[model samples]
Target: MHLTFTTLAANQTHYFLALCLELEKQGYSTSIISFHEESNKLIADAGIKVFNVFEIYRIEKEKNLNIENEFSALLSKYQIECPNILLSHEKVTFLIKDSIQLKEKFVLYFKALEKFFNELKQTHQNNVVLFQELGGFASIVSSFYVARGMGYDNIYFEPSFFKGRMFFVKNTFESYKVQENFSLPIEPNVLAYLENARANKTIVIPKKDASHYQHPIRKIVNTHNIKRLFQKLFSKYLSNQKEEFNYIGSFVYRHIRMLTNRFLFIKYYQPIPSEKFVYYPFHVPMDVALTVRAPLFVDQYYLIDYISRNIPNGYSLAIKEHPAMIGVVEYKRIKDLLSRNDNIVFLNPDINNHEVMTRMDLLLTVNSKTGAESLMQGRKVICLGDAFYNKSKSVRFVDNIDNLYKHINTALKNNAPNIDDINVFFNSTYSQTHIGELYYCSKENIAQSSLSISQYVKANYGK
Candidate 1:
């Protein structure tokens, strides 16, 4: 079997390298398509074939082939719906501000990816698979579309709701599904984790290193990252590298904006209200969880305003910043929402999420894990977007926002989920998930994750 790994960062590069080495022992060959040049060098040093995407883009650009009707033709040829989310990726919008430039660049990327995938298909045929870390960035998204168009088996991986487990799916930002008759015995640890979460205790997941938020300044001052920053600076100015993405520039801009917003808006956050309230936690901006999975709720401020206007008369809508985005979100928009909506209140970002859930009458979310957490706590939840736990008996999935009030009322009137139903839902999830971490690159994690992945491929693809 031949595996092609897509790596966008240093951590992912390390993780994929470990997977490649482990899988090689089992007679599988591996290659890499790296979006970051630093990752490309690291992969190459490991004695593996690595293709840099920028080099591919440059090669395709030199052809100067007409792509005037390529986008429409590609869609028709591949039977793929227009990939709006790929074009809307933050990297594309941030780097190419002009509309004409953006379209030209996208067409060039599409052409390059199509040609690259054609060659890969010719070489590996049905023996190849593509692995991508879950993301909404341009390169990954474009690659996914092109690979699917060329009839390749591609899997997107992300950390699951359970600790130390990962889920894989084929569609961008889609959740994994288990057979309706899934009958695996529920793991005792899964039950224990649910009980602990119900008691308002912290529950750790694979991607989380700690339960608390780390300040942006602390992240910037780290020795390894500082060294990386310097290396990137040198590469940008002193080297002849043609990079598609500016990692250092994006990092600096994000943190500077984060710090400025933190200083200016800390005073505006209020405590969770004593009155009866329904909670709405903010989703991280530019996160695939929002941009790809729930594009309708991308402007959360508007969603909040709509929710506040329709919520039951006696209940207020309590909102909080996502911990990962404490200072990263735009405060002016939040300020405008707060000023206009009297029924809405901003909770301090420092408040423990479980504590807030315990005090709220209901939870409202756009595909957030908090919806799952709220269900564990026996709190009624109304989901405004696609979520892995949307099938839970405790959740009310709202298909249309115009009828938001009707759903809210229905959820508020419904009883808490039965323990048996919760068990069944989680047991189904466990049946679908493989025991592993996504980005954690510890030796034990690497071994376990690689074994799980290899077993899955062997069973599914007979490789």
Candidate 2:
């Protein structure tokens, strides 16, 4: 099978190239359709056919015609009339869609992609598969559009870990073997592979760098005045509303008491007091809600107030700031609500989520990977909203703050979490066992979904 990879981001490098290299080693002809000059250079340097679309458009004005015409030129450059299966990055496709206009520029790129897909359909016909690396609404939408264009029944979205530098070498090899033996028309087979593939994976390298998040050090030096100024400026341009700075100032004042506990310290590495409290780690990117005419921050504050009124007199709450959004806003509203009752504490952090999870009594969060990690550690995880990991029977989710006191009473009264249950859950979600051989078959999998020579011609020439 032969494969073509088309992508635009000059700075971003994807696993498609590596996947192509592996396929080539297994005796398949692999080529690249690079959108950027730099990427074309890299592909050529690697001794592969490099279809430099950007350069072609630069040098030839005719190439600037409808995207379909430019696409035909690109296909001709690569000597591919049609391909068996055409694979491109979903994110890049969406970025291009959003970046271009539908009249001329959009039509041009669409034609290029359509030509590529049509060629695949003509050459390979029923063998085309569109793959999504990051499975989300956007990825699914992108796949739907591409599948419609190519008339492909087989569409697949693989796990994020199985791509890039982090993919397990053994797993890829095993998948290759399986694909070689597997029959054609692989939609159902691919779906089955995805279900089992999750548990069959190994931790080859630590997950991609945790450095992608906001630094924790910013919390210490960012005083109330600075944060207030930021709040004013943001409210003017981004969110034209005033933040209650005084409330936050008072809230930070009370957090100074956490210093009493040597082991319970927050960002400064202090200790936490052995007090019974509910920990809520706020998740962000909710600011996007404003675009849809939603008042997200206000709703969050109201929820915090409800929790403050309902929690029992002696017990308290702990709120953790999202690592991504440290200085922009504070959990002061939640803090002030709890302060009226003197039962809520906000934890500052100098470290990462792994360390924070270890120090907590119970984790209360929304849909986050932390929910999964907490369950893996056999900790009490309470999810407040719909997150991917919330469907577990092992984790508790509080939908309403009105029931917060009752639930806490019930949990403390019983606290019946089974170690065996935790072990079973962990094994189901993360444990890597038995299916180590599957990784070796990765090449076969690639080949099975790969496009053949004849398929490319039909997709492009509208045969």
Best-fitting candidate, measured by lDDT? 1
TM-score for each of the candidates: 0.92, 0.50
lDDT of 2 by residue, 47-149 (tens): 8765554333333445456555544554454344322111112212122232222223323334444555666667665554443222222213223345454
The segments of candidate 1 whose C-alpha lies over 4 angstroms from its true place after superposition are 63-73, 91-96, 171-173, 178-183, 208-212, 242-247
Top candidate when judged by TM-score against the true structure: 1
Ten-residue stretch with the least lDDT total in model 2: 171-180
The TM-score, computed over Cα atoms with residue i paired to residue i, of candidate 1 is: 0.92
* Residue-level lDDT tens digits of model 1 in 1-463: 7888887767778888888888888889888877777677778888887877777677777876566565566657666575565556564325334444455566666676776677777788868788887777767777787777777877988777788888888655576644423356777887877777676567454563442256666665668667877777887778756444555677777767877887777778888899999999998767787877788888888889999998999999999988766777787887898889889888888788988998999999998888877877777888888788876665787878898898888878878777677777776777788888876888899889888889889888998
Clashes of 1: 0
lDDT agreement with native, every candidate = 0.76, 0.43
